[model samples]
Target: MKNLKLAAAIAAAVSCGPALAQTEIVWWHAHGGQLGETVNSIAEQFNASQSEIVLTPVFKGGYEDTLTATIAAFRAGEQPNIVQVFDAGAATIIGAQGAVIPAEDLMTQAGVEFDANNYISGVRYFYADSEGKMVGMPFNSSTPILYYNIAALEKAGVEPPKTWEEFESIAPAIVDAGYIPLAQSHSPWIWTENFHSRHNLPFASNNNGFDGSDGTKILVNNDAIKMHFSKVKEWLDKGWYAYYGAGWGDNQTPFENSEVAMWLGSSGSFGGLLNSVDFEFSATYLPYWEAITSEPTQTFIGGAALFALTGHSDEENKATAEFFKFLSSTDVQKFWHKETGYVPITTAAYEAAKAEGYYDEKPQAEIGIKQLSLPSGDNSKGYRMGFYVQIRDVMNREYGRIFAGETDVESAFNVIEEEGNKLLDRFSKTN
Candidate 1:
């Protein structure tokens, strides 16, 4: 009887003993709606792939909002294990000093195999520090591309323009065909910043703040920039370009209804557009000025990256590294690239897409990749200025003043330079 009771007690203890506790890692992100669903699916898959970690993806509003929340959370010692920060916020997060773990260190310390060179040059350097150390994991990268309605272009008897001059020549016909020739929301990242980078013009001093951010100055008053603005103002005046104010989605409805023939939008919009549009459409590289250069320079990236925060337990950090490793896998990357229109982050993912003939079936999807694959120039490296998001806001406000006839192009840019320099100075002081 004693032996029987002892065996029963042992069996009970074994059954009740705590099962392995999963290290739950919360990931705050800005992806919402369909993209949010996709993000959740990724988390689910990663959780199923391992029993040691449970990734919980939380929707934390838009990019700016998410960054703000992360900063607040960090101050309170309640930051999530991981946060998705937009490209513009890269410098701000990096300059925060000990706010987050460097991705290279995170992977190395966790014993995960990490190769920073696996990321493409166009994207790899954008998130790297002064000494070329990657501070964040590149994810959901995109370049600005021009999307055009094929039927509208055909009815207008013109091909999509490859050059700014060609676009000017074809604008009248597109307008006469009873369609808005072009329209874009107030995205200076596409119009001013990337334009400068693509033409090898300096948007700011100190190699666009890549060398150092201490004394960077705004430099948007060049003749090339002025000429482009002059043409845009002319187009707006002639009713060839429609102005929809300063919000991101204000012009999307017009384009989707086929009322607008062409618009400058993110390459990330391709997947959503495939489901939203009834009209046949295609996308191509952002039009460039032939006079500015012999060929178009490599365009910079816009989109967010995954950054690991500090103050997490070692096990939690290891789980974050595991998630990052999963994200870097070729299969995962290919799935992400196909599900979203963003460029694949790794060369292996791109090769997988090519071998599967995915790009052939949807050639428009590959345009952004081809553009980013082009050789990077000295000026086209990428923007790394402090408070870049605020700088973009300054640029957009000046653009509104120019379009509303409140200010001339040169004067508006001068205002941008003065106002933007103040913001940069403030950021430099804080860092």
Candidate 2:
């Protein structure tokens, strides 16, 4: 009877199967609002699809704030498994090689197949190294595109601008039509980062830092950038432009509130802008200075990428790799692109969406992808400067002087480059 009982217990154990160890993998991210919710949804879907790994996404404020928290945690030896860093900070994160497991290496170590060819060309390369080894998973990739109020343009009898000359010509009429012409923020993003890329001008030497650490100096004093700042100041004086002091979606408010007729902002604003405004609007490629360049060769990336933090268990890293594979799948990428305004990161996801007529259903949505898909150049690939946040702060202070008409473009540009380079040097030495 005892033997029968033992056999019954063994049978029951075999039938029930071994326990599924729910390894908790924490993800720290910077996105908030609807975008934040979308992130949570992705985590939930990933958890439901797999039983071994459970992901918990913790909102860590803006990109800067998230970086601060992650650094603190790392110092405390309590770092999360994953972190999302903006493109501007990509260099710093990549520089901290000891603290991170490059996404490519992590995937390889976990025995996951990750190919650089799988991602959207422009987006993928932004997070990759000189050897094309992906350092992080390109999360939400965007390029600045021109968003305009259709009714305002039509009312002023002005076609959408294809060149800076056209924008200049239409500025007066747009203002006269009871609309602020351009709603630009006083950030380094539109005024500096995207400006260099749109014109195919190098922001730094050595192929805009794509050739590695050789190109660490600041190059903002170039003719193209000086020309851009002069133009911006001119527009501001003419009331053809208004200054907003935020980045990303903050530029959207002026357009939605009828305070401005046109704006240049991240393409990730696509869905948010559509939801925020009840007006006829359209998107186009960023206008170029016809004098400097007839057309835009390519534009740089403006979104964040996903990096896996080091000092975690091998099992946790494996689970992180699995989660990334799931996120990079065609279906998830497609849904993410549709749900949020970010373009798909993977080429297969993009093709799948196009085959399903995603662009036809929403024509304006293609503008960003089109802008990014333009012919590439060394300058347009992206920038890699250490302590980029400090450089941006230096730019913001100098740009404020430009907006206030307190300093001329040449002087401001000179100061920005000098101040920015100092931080880069300090970062190089200490970090």
Alpha carbon lDDT of each predicted model? 0.87, 0.83
| Full-model lDDT, candidate 2 | 0.83
Give the alpha carbon lDDT tens digit for every residue of 98-192 in model 1: 98898989999999999887887778878877777888898889988899999999999999999888999999999999999998864588888
lDDT of 2 by residue, 306-335 (tens): 999999999999999999999999999999
| Most accurate candidate by TM-score | 1
Could you tell me which 10 consecutive residues in candidate 2 have the lowest summed lDDT?
A: 5-14
Off by over 4 Å in 1: 1-21
Candidate 2's C-alpha runs over 4 A off are 1-16, 211-215, 246-250
- CA shift of 384, model 2, Å: 1.0
The estimated TM-scores of all candidates read 0.93, 0.92
Clashing pairs in 1: none
User: Residue pairs in steric clash, candidate 2?
Assistant: none
Q: For candidate 1, which ten residues in a row score worst on lDDT?
A: 5-14
